[model samples]
Target: MRQRHKPWADEFLQENTHLIIPDPSNYKNKWHEVFENNNPIHVEIGTGKGQFIAGMAKQFPSINFIGIELAKSVIVSAAEKVQESEHANIRLINENAENLLDMFMTDEISTIYLNFSDPWPKNRHEKRRLTFHSFLKRYENVLKPDGELILKTDNRGLFEYSLVSFSNYGMTLQEVSLDLHALNDPENIMTEYEEKFSAKGQQIYRCKAVFPNQK
Candidate 1:
């Protein structure tokens, strides 16, 4: 789907630099300094409209949340939500996930969330999928040894591909749910896309995978 351009996106980003960090690479391993606490950091890649990150921040006040989104227009909307919530533990990064290593150091992130990401189902575009091996390598590099990578998506193809990718990378699957909403998990924070899909009676797939100990 083509992105709808927002004319005020540039101004919004300029006015709210604190909420949507700029030159985030400078912070690298010092993310704790940004949140002013040593709390574990959790990141949501492709954080659309900030629903999941904002909800998670409100749900877990002790953990810092960083949302990485590449679309300026889309991220502006996310920043707006964070700004209104006034959640001190949440921050947004208007950057691409491919540059994760540039913005975080080894063991800097405790958990990573991939919520309703684009499937990129075509065989030719496999590498562009968030669960592709290249992206998993980046996640492994920044994530703590026991860091958990949680994924929630309505796309079964992507979910299945991710499971294989994780296992091939020697990651352990701690939990797998073919129908996440069927469990009625109270702790599950629904993203905007998840809400819409669930309303249509679509099943949600979720999995929590952790990397093997880095001996």
Candidate 2:
């Protein structure tokens, strides 16, 4: 789906740089300084409209949440929600996930969330998928030794592909849910897409995988 352009997106970002961090690469290993605490940092790579990240921040006050979104128009809405929530533990980054290594150091992140990411189903676009090997490599580098990656999607093909990808990467699957909503996990924070898809009777898939510790 094409993103609807917001004419005031630039202005909104300029005014709310605090909520949606500008030049996040500058933060690097200093994210704790940005949050003003040494709390564990959890990142949601495709933070659509800010619902999940904001909700997670409210749910886990001791953990710092950072949302990375590439779309200017979409991220502006996310920033608005973060602002309205008045949650100081949350921050937004208007940047691409491919640049994760540039913005964080080794073992800098505690957990990574991939929610309803673009499936990029074509064989030629396999590398573009967030679960692709290159992206997983990046995640492994930035994530702490004990850190785990959590993924949620309604797309079965993508879910299956990710399971294979994680296995090939030598990551251990901590948990797998074929029908996440059926489990009615109270701790589960639903993204806007998850809520919409679940309302339409679509089954949600979720998995948590941790990287093998380096010897």
Candidate 3:
């Protein structure tokens, strides 16, 4: 089901424009300058409503976090969450994942997160999956040497597909878990969808992969 467009979406985004990098592409190779610090950067693509990234920013104050979402309507929810508190380490970007290369130079990012991304369940739509190798190539270009890509999803099929895709890309896989909540990682921070799905007894899948840039 598609989400209905909220009437206030545009207004909300405009009002909170300071929290977003209006010309992210211009900051290519200069992300740390934008944040005004040299802290390691962690990014979350499709950061719906921002809970996970916000929690992470609170948990790790020394790390800079960026949350990217394409839809103005969807991203407004995330902007609202940031506005509710003081989070200097976090910022939101309204942009598409496909255009990430335009906004970041090679080896600019330290970590990438793909949490409950759209499955795009049809075989013909495989390229649209965030875990697709094509997307992984983009991520690899932005990630610093040995940078990590962490993923969490409730869709078993997507999880399975991502596992094979990451393997085929020759990434070193680690921390693979078919049931994330069961692992009981004390540091685990739940995303909005994760909380709802877990309440319904759904098993969440998660994994970490490192891009071996030299190998």
Per-model TM-score, in order, reads: 0.98, 0.99, 0.96
Q: Say which prediction, candidate 2 or candidate 3, comes out ahead on TM-score.
A: 2
Q: Of the pair 1 and 3, which is ahead by TM-score?
A: 1
- Candidate 3 local distance difference test against the native: 0.90
Candidate 2 global lDDT: 0.95
Give the winner by TM-score: 2
User: lDDT of all the models against the reference?
Assistant: 0.93, 0.95, 0.90
Q: Per-residue lDDT of 1-215 in model 2, one digit per residue for the tens?
A: 78899999999989988888999999999999999999999999999999999999999999999999999989998988988899999999999999999999999999999999999999999999999999999999999999989999999999999999999999999999999988989999999999899999999999999999972
TM-score of model 2 (CA atoms): 0.99
lDDT tens readout by residue for model 3, 15-65: 776787787898888878878999999999999988898899899999999
Tell me, by lDDT, which candidate is best: 2
Worst lDDT 10-window in candidate 2: 206-215
Model 3 earns a TM-score of 0.96
Clashes of each: 0, 0, 0
Model 1 weakest lDDT span, ten residues long: 206-215
Instruction: TM-score for candidate 1, please give it.
Output: 0.98
Q: Candidate 2, residue 101: CA error in Å?
A: 0.3
